[model samples]
Target: MAHQERVVALLRQPNSMIAEGFAFMEAQFVALHEDIYVAQPKGFEDPVHPNHVYKLRKAFYGLKQAPRVWYEQLTQYLLHHGYDRGSVDKRLLVKTTRNHVTIAQIYADDIVFGSTLQKYTDDLVEVMNKEFEMSIVGQMTYFLGLQVKQSSEGYFISQKKYAKNLVKKFELESSKTPRTLISTSTKLSKDDAGPPIDSTVYRSLIGSLLYLTASRPDIMFSFGMCARHQSAPKKSHLIAAKRILKYVRGTIKYGIWYSKESELSVTGYCDADWAGNIDDRKSTSGGCFFVGKELSIMAEQETKLNFSEHS
Candidate 1:
């Protein structure tokens, strides 16, 4: 999915790309499950014996090899059409002829194809339609829950709708807004001996919040801190997590904006807060890479190696 972000960033320049979508289901497979056969569904039974295993000629959703088979099929198709698979990201396929360049990104069934020329896009859609089961999704807008708004100023990616739904899901729509995601003075340590909360509920909340971090990077650290205590989350930890939601409630519309005006430049920022995880005496290391002032990757990891936690 990080490849998905790269594709979107490539489109930041106005008129740099024209996109369309194509997606399909399972592909035909020559290999059988476990190199033998699998039990058929109740209705598609074997005549010899109902208990005997069966074989399949096509890949289906549930099979482990389905994704691999489907990818190989897609790769062969692209190669047959003069496109070269990206050495960096296998999911990316590219075709270039003189000045015209076309790129396609494959994610399971979904495909995002774009080109410098309309003829290339039209040709791709035409051939793909002839070979696969898919239809044009037209110009890219909303994809994978990331609401996209693209124009002369570049793109704005947000999960406002998802965040709103999350607030409602957690019953925090009516909660007070928090000035900060994690209160400055608040501290969450594993050995606090605070009253324990429902582990199942705490985990559920953590999972929901983690998904929201895709667009809400601001709450990433605070929300992730609460996740460490999933095994024994306490009332204090839950309150910290709720504070993040409270902040989200106020800035529900906040999103990452890629400005076209910014010059093309790359920068990286990294830092570590020593002994941030009090319970384990571990520090948190944070790093991010930027493309023309737009953040492309943000990573946070907890490191027990104190030597690597220098300011």
Candidate 2:
């Protein structure tokens, strides 16, 4: 998703279009290179060959090899038509003609693409239609769970619906909103003696919040602290997690804005705490990388250290 966002932020300066392969995964349009056979389904067996298995000439939903076959098919088609696969990301395909360059990003069967000229985008759709079934999404408003709002100024990306659903899932819709996600003075630790809570519920909440951090970097550290006790979460840990939900409730519409005014230069910021974890006394380090003003990448992890026996 980070890669997708970065690509959009970088390449969306020009005309852009989004397309999806109709019935992409379950479609029988994918041809198999290797011969395979499967048992006939009920009511589909032939009368003469009742015991014989059916030979597969095309990829199907239940087949484990279907996804790979479809990807290979698309790759071969793009390569044959002058599109060069990206050295870093194989799914990214680029075609250069004269001074105009068209960029296409493949996410399974969906394609998000753009070019400096309108004709390039039109030609791309024309050729794709001749080869495969496609549904042109016109302008990209939503993709990969991120809500996109594009304008002359720039793009606004968020997950408002996902956040609302998350609040409802945990039954925290009517809960009072908290000013802070977590108290600055509060330090979460394994409460071995405290009353136990459902580990599954605690883990699920933590996981969802972690995903939300993709677009909301402010909650990263606070949620990371609550995530440590997922294996044996207690009442205190659950409370901390719920606080994050309340905070999310109040800030559901918040999102990052990628402006056309900002330069494409990459910038990164990193910070760390000294022995922040109370249980293990390990420092947590984190970094955020941005393309212009838009955050494109973020990561956080605990540091491991070895102590000397003499000390």
Candidate 3:
């Protein structure tokens, strides 16, 4: 019911052309039902039946065709207005004019839109409001649990608040912070002789860190290494998990910063050791990509540029 109301509101907003479209549809339905029975199927035998209700003249809320009908209607309107749907992501609508371009992303009832020029953005909003009943929330801050921090330099996305909540949820407030993600000397093994811990807790910690990796690529290798032992995690695996949490505690404020000066150029460096893992005797590969010269230097300094250890 709520969904239907929302769709109807979008069609009935002031200055909306959808009203005219709806009227046209209603007229078509009436013309189609002129000779056909307008009452319930069972009541069609009795013309004077008072309890008989009129059959639906147009797509109704519970009808299976409702979504398709609405989609066709909206798509036709956008196509007429010069908006093109993205090939890969259909929810993305783009409109490019002589001086500016506007993009809108649709996620069910929510929308995220941006533009290269303010006039274009405003024009889109006005047109949408004229056709749909929508409330613009203005500048976006948090969407789908990602905390967006936009700056003149570039956008910085993180989940600091979500990380804090996770820390509290796991009761890791008393844990000591670790200096490094993992110790070079410590080697984790699937030890049959070692003591076992709660596999559920170990898996939960890994899951949390996996999500943190969205903005904290520094821990990707370490997390991937620890994830291999989730099937029968031992004390050593738990220790590694705690180490990652401690690292998070120490660097909660850390995040990736996309600079405005950054170009579209993509460069990558890969290095691996002969046999970094003692258990499987398999090599550990590490690599990082850069968009600009600044990122290349940063990656070099942080990764140590040691091909021997990485290769």
Candidate 4:
């Protein structure tokens, strides 16, 4: 997800355009390399061949090899169209014609592509349509829970709809919103005597917030703190987790803005708290990387290294 965000941030420029689309019958288009047999369906079975299983020539949706064959097929098509697979990230494909470079990133069957010139994007779409059944969703507005608003200045990315759904999913619409995500004075520990909450529910909250972190950097620290207690969440831990939801409810529309005029220089900030975890006395280390004004990556890790061990 961070890689995708970085690509968008770098590709987006003044007067540039980006588009997204998915392949129709994504997996069915590919031919299976290895022979696969399946029991014939009740209505489609031939009377004489009723005792025999059908050998698959094409990939099926539930087949384990479906994704691989589909990916290979798409790769061949893109390579034939003059796109080069990214050396570092295999999912990224790039095509350069003189000074104009067009980039496309693939996630399963969905493809998001852009270029400095609109013509390059259009030409690619045309070729893709010719090769495969393409559903060209012109101008990317939303993809994979992230809402993108592209303008001449830059792109505004957010998950406004997803946030609203999250609030409603947990029936927290009536709950009061909080100004701060989590209280600074709050100290959560595994040994807390607070009543134990359902571990599954606690994990669901953590998992949802983790996905929300893809577009919300402000929640990263607080979210990480609450996630640590997922193994055996207590009432206090759940309360701390709900506090984040309350905060998100208040600032649901908040998002990062990438400016086209901002410099391409990369900047990073990293820090660690010594022996911060009350349970294991381990330190928490975190870093955030920015491309120009937009945050491209943010991560937090609870390290095993302890000050007492070194001492």
Number of the top-ranking candidate, with TM-score as the measure? 4
The ten-residue window of minimal lDDT in model 1 covers 25-34
- Across 11-82, the per-residue lDDT of candidate 4 in tens digits comes to 665767888987757534678888888998888888887888988879866677877888888888889989
The better candidate by lDDT, 1 or 3, is 1
lDDT of 2 by residue, 1-311 (tens): 33444454445554543443343544436889999999888998889989999788888765788767877887788788898888779989887777666778777657787765678888888777777777776778777778888777777889898999999999999999999999888988888899998888999999999889867888888898998898899999999999998998999998888776676677899998878888888999999987777687888999965566873
| Candidate 3, residue 51: lDDT | 67
- Give a tens-digit lDDT track for model 1, residues 1-311: 33433444456546655455656452333233345467768878877787878666667666778777777777788899998777768888887766666788888767878875677778888877777777676778877788888787777889988888988988998899978888677768884568888988888889988988888788888877888889888898888888888899899899998776665567889998788776777989998887667787899999895455566
TM-score, structure 3 vs. true: 0.64
Best by lDDT: 4
Where in model 3 is the C-alpha error above 4 Å?
1-95, 130-132, 293-311
Please give, for residues 1-311, the per-residue lDDT of candidate 3 as tens digits. Answer: 22222222222222221100111232122112222234466635655666666656555443445445545555556677898877756766677666455666665345677665667777877776666555666667777667877655456677888788877878888888888999988777787788999999999889988888877888877887788889999998988878888888878887776555544455778777656666667776667766542233222112222345554
Clashes of each: 0, 0, 5, 0
Given candidate 1, what's the lDDT at residue 274?
85
Clashing pairs in 3: 271-310, 272-310, 272-311, 273-310, 273-311
Ranking by TM-score: 4, 2, 1, 3
Q: Every model's Cα RMSD, please?
A: 3.9, 3.0, 11.6, 2.6
TM-score each candidate.
Answer: 0.84, 0.88, 0.64, 0.92
Candidate 1 global TM-score: 0.84
